[model samples]
Structure formats: structure tokens, C-alpha cells
Target: MDFALSQEQQMMQRLMRDICSDYGLEYWREKDEAKEFPHEIWDDLTEAGFTGLTIPEKYGGEGLGMEEIVAVGLALGRHGGGVSGPNMLTLGPVFGGISLTEHGNEDQKERWLPEIVDGAIVSLGLTEPDAGLDTAGIKTTAEKDGDEYVLNGTKIWTTGAHVSDYIVTLARTSPMEEGSRHQGISLFVVPSDADGITTNKIDKLSMRCLGSCEVVFDDVRVSEANLLGDEDSGFYHVLGTLNTERIIWSAIPLSAGELALDLAVDYAKEREAFERPIGKNQGVQFPLAESKMELETAKLMIYKAASLYDSGEDCSMEANAAKFIAARAGSNACDRAIQVHGGMGFADEYHVERLYRDVRLARVAPVSDELVKSFVSTNVLDLPRSY
Candidate 1:
């Protein structure tokens, strides 16, 4: 398969890179330090038309596919966004735009799709205190009452909820069956300011600029029209978005690794040790070389998975594998970048530390590497399910 970028794709990359460069590493560093979202940069992205890359053209979007979004993710990561890069677009465009387009009824699409393209921030409410990786075990419930649904439960790690205009939430509509926990779940578009909804921010290890929080739903009500797809079929709908999310999340860290490696290489060539460039030493040279190879290899799988997803193929295995490999490779590259920078790596001014801290979240989030391995073990290797 031809892996080379077409002229259009190259232009997209250049556009994203230029926009991100305007913000630079220092802009990100200050945002992270203050634990503030990068609103200016996000506005820049929206104004530049990057935020609507995945939305359908009819809804004032660019009508792009997963491959194009993946390219945007890579460019954002490589420039200055690090972990927060993909979050800027993913919440609104992917969660709100793609979910509505793929599964929402005509009314739902007409109501939300254009809003997403118009720069409405949409946070996701899927992970719960008890249902981090075990989506089937979620305790959140949405009960039908007349013409509305009353949602009651808690969602943990609801990223960007404080600033988001709306939240795409998943909740159980019925009790779990003995043999099937995936049933009875449903998706809804919840207004963040719905009467009974409350959100409290959570301070985490990284991606401080993008807040993750605990969102409580105490009889939060929404009209029947808020449901995205057929009742009891939200899990299936979520499956479609999850794979796309995996592919883009893989690109974020994968390109963050590229940025880290580039910075380390530049540092190595200039930093002197023992009367010679430290990069001349085998210790530094070997790890950086290994990181380059790993990052390059992961990049290939990331785009391959994206391509498969855009073609409407079953890419669960490939997407999971890409996320697993890219997260590990990206984290390893940041670790090596830190090692190469030596003392400066721990310092924030050099930037590798920030990249390392931020990209490290990829190893555990958007789906953990362990869960990915289990997915591959059962589906790809024909092995028994371990978990």
C-alpha cells in the first residue's frame, strides 16, 4: 500500500503545524502550570477550521474521514499540544459530530452537528468510578419517565466537563443480565447545565490544561429526543466511535514521541560531555536510535488502522494494537529523550519533561495497554479471554 502523503494531506499537516507553532511550547507550559485549558489555542484551531475536520460537510464541517483526523492529531502533537492536542478536537468533533452523524436521528443531527462545528465544546461521560475499563459494569442509570429520561449516577474522569457546553453520556437503561452486561446501555446528549448535573474537577498527574472531573447526575433530565440511537444499542454505537478514538489517540502520543526525539537529538548534538558531543557516545546514540525505529514502526500501524476505519472495516484488533504499540513506543521515546537530556530532562524549560509527563497518560488512558493486550490475545491470537 502506498504510505506516502498526498499533496492535500501535506497541506493539512502544514496548516496544523503552523497553527500550533504560533502557540509554541512555552504557551503550553504556562497553561499546564496554571492548570488552565488552552482556550486561545483551541480558538485558533477552531477558527483555522481544524476543529471541524471530522464533521460532515453539510453541517458546516470539512467532511473529512479518520485518516485526515489522524494526520491532524499527529501534527498537533508534534508541534506543541502533546497530550492535550487531540483533546481539542476529539471531544467535540468525534464524540459529538461523529456519534450524531453515525447514529443520531435526523432531529438529533440537525440540533447538534452544526453546533459542534460552530465551536461548541463537548465532553464525554463514559468512564465511571467503578467502570473505568469495565464499561459493562457502569452503575449510571437512565430511567424513562413520561417524555423525559432521569439519569442518576456518577461519572469519573469526565474530561473538559467544566467548560463543555454539552456532554455525551452513556448509562444503563435496564438491569444487567446474567450472561450479558453490555445490554441495556444507552447514549444521550446531556446539557452540562441540566438542573441536577454537577461537576467537580480532578487534579491529575498530567494534561493539567485539560481538566478531568467527577460529574454527578442526580435525576438529571433530558428529553426523549436526546437519545442518540436505538435504545439498548448504545454500546454498539460506542464501539464505532471507540475504534476511531483509539486510532487518533495513538497518533497523539506517537507524534509526541517524534517531537521528544527531535528535541533530544538537537540537545545531544549540542550538549558537550568529556570534550565531545554526548550524542557521539553509544549509550545516548543507541537508545535514541531505538526510539526512532519504534516511533516510525508505530506510526505506520496508526495510519493503517485509520485507513481501515475510514473504509468501514472491522478494525478492532488493528486499532487496539496500534494504540498499544504507539502508547508504549511513544512513552519509551519520551523516557529516552529524558535520559538523553540528562539533568535538563527533569527541568520544564527543556520541554521533554512536559512531553514525558503528558504523553505518559496514553499508557493508561483512552483504554489501557493491558486491556489492549487482552483484546489481541482473545481476538487476534484465538486465545481464551483472560479477563
Candidate 2:
């Protein structure tokens, strides 16, 4: 099996590196300190055509595959952390393109995907106040009218909701099936200003500059044309879309792990302790060595997952395993980086502190650590599924 980047893939990585080179940890740290999103950098990425790298070319996108997509995200994350790359780019593809690419009529694609590629923001509405990882439990419902659906319910932990102009929201369209819990669930596109929508900011533990909103939909109206896929099949389709999401998440953390390792190694060479460079000490040298090993392992797993996804293979187990391993390695890498930097690491002025906080966010959402374990145990080992 060939395991090499094509000329085009290398070129995309070079382009992303050039763009991300200008937005270092200091720029991200300053944005985090202000609790504000980086629209200036956002504009730059938009201008670069990197924002909609996954959206179809017919809709004014580059139509790049997962290999190129991961390459772009990883290069950015290797410098700017998650938000500056995957966290910022993946939402548009996952939510904006989930329906548009798979089910959108020509008009829908014409109406939305081009703008999304051109930097019009889009986001998803799946995780609700009550629905964490149990997407089937989503209480949000869109009742059908003659040509429009009146939507009402609440969604929580919605990232980029405030800035996005459109949302692919999952809602209950039919009453629950007698035996199946996932049935009767549907997805729809809702305009951000659809009359009855309201958002309140949810204070976050980290990625503070990345906005998550608790949104309430009060009788919002949407046309029937906005339905994402066949009514009552959205749950399956949404889950399908997330396989890519997991890869993107997995790939992103690997990049962050690289950044963490880079920070630790560079710091060790320059910082002095006991009249010698910290690089000479085993305490310093060992952790960095182990971190290098772990980061490389995690990266291989991420690529394995991404390649399987690109080949249209069954990648659930690989994706879950990659995300689990990569996130832990990313956490370990940042922690080790911070430890290597000593007091300077804790001080945001030195930058490792920001990586520490951002790296922690890799664990909590998308799929929680416990849930990923459950997925592997049940799906891969052929054990019983856990509730």
C-alpha cells in the first residue's frame, strides 16, 4: 500500500503552513484573553479558499478529499491550536455540507454551499441541553405545516452558533417509532434569524474564545425544502457524517500534539537549570522522547482512520480508537510540555499554558472518553452495546 502524499497534497500543506505561520500561539492567546473570535484571521482563511476545502467544487469549493482536508487542518493546528483550524473549518463541512452535499437539491446547493465556501459561516444543532451524546434523545422537534415546518426546542453546546448564518438542526419530525428510538428523528436547515431563535453564551472551561451557545427555538418556521435527508432518517445520516467528524477531530489533536512537542523540545534547549541546559537532564529528556514517540503513534492512527474513511471502508472502530489515543497523547504532550517549562509554562506569557487548556478540550466533547471506550469494546470486540 502506498503511504505517500501526492504533489497536490504537499502543496496544500505548504499553503496552510504559510497562512498559519503568521498566527502563532501569541495571537491565539491574545484572542482567548479577550474572549473573542478571530475574525481577521477568519477573513484570511476565507480569502485563502481554505474555509470550504471540503465543499463541492460545483458549489464554488475545491472538492478536496479527506487526505487534503486533514493535511490542511493538521498544518494549521501544528501552530494555531484547534480553533484556528479544524474547530473553525470542520463545522461548515459537517453541518453545512452534511445535507447540502448528500441531499441538497441543486437550488439548495446554489443557495448555500458557495457562500459557505466563500466564508459564510454554518453550524450544527444536535447536542441539546438533555441530549449530550445521546443524539436520539434530542427534544427539539419541527412540526410539519403545508410547506413549512415550525421548529421549537432547545440546543446546548452549539459551537459557532452566533456567527453562523445557517444551521443544520436535528429535530423530531414524526413521533418516536414503537420499537426503535432513533426513528422519526429528522434534520432541517434553519436560518439563524428565523424569527423565534435566541442564543445565550455558555461559559466554557477552555477554547473560551471559541463560542458555544445554548439556543432556544420558539416556533421558528422553515420550508419543507430545508429537510436534510428523508424525514425520519436523519439520525442515521447524521451519524454517518460524524465518522468524518471523528477523523477531523482525531487529525486535529495530532497536530496540537505536534505543537506541544515542538514547544517542549524548543524550551528544553534554551532554558537553563543548575547552570546547564534542561535538555541535558533525564527528567527533561525522557518525557520529550516519550512524547515524540506517542505523538508519532497517534498521528499514524489518525492517518489510518482518515485513509479508511476515504476508501469508504467501515471505519467506526478505527475512528474511535484514533480519537481516543490521539486525544490522550495530545493531553499528555501538553502536560509534559508545561512540566518542561516549569513556572514559565503556567504563565500564559510563555504560551504552553494556552496549549494545556486547549488540549484539555479535546477530551470532553464530540465523543467523551468513556463513550469512545464503550464504542470500541462493543463494536470491535463484539461485546454487548452499553447504554
| Best-matching candidate per lDDT | 1
Deviating ranges (above 4 Å) for candidate 2: 82-84
> Model 1 over residues 267-356: C-alpha lDDT tens digits?
999999889999999999999999999999998998889889889888999899899999999999999999999888999899999989
lDDT of each: 0.89, 0.82
Model 1 sits at a Cα RMSD from the real structure of 1.0
- At residue 386, give the lDDT of candidate 1: 92
- Relative to the unseen true structure, what is the C-alpha lDDT of residue 379 in candidate 2, on a scale of 0 to 100? 78
TM-scores for all predictions: 0.98, 0.97
Q: What is the lDDT of residue 117 in candidate 1?
A: 83
Off by over 4 Å in 1: none
Tell me the deviation in Å of residue 121 in model 2: 1.0
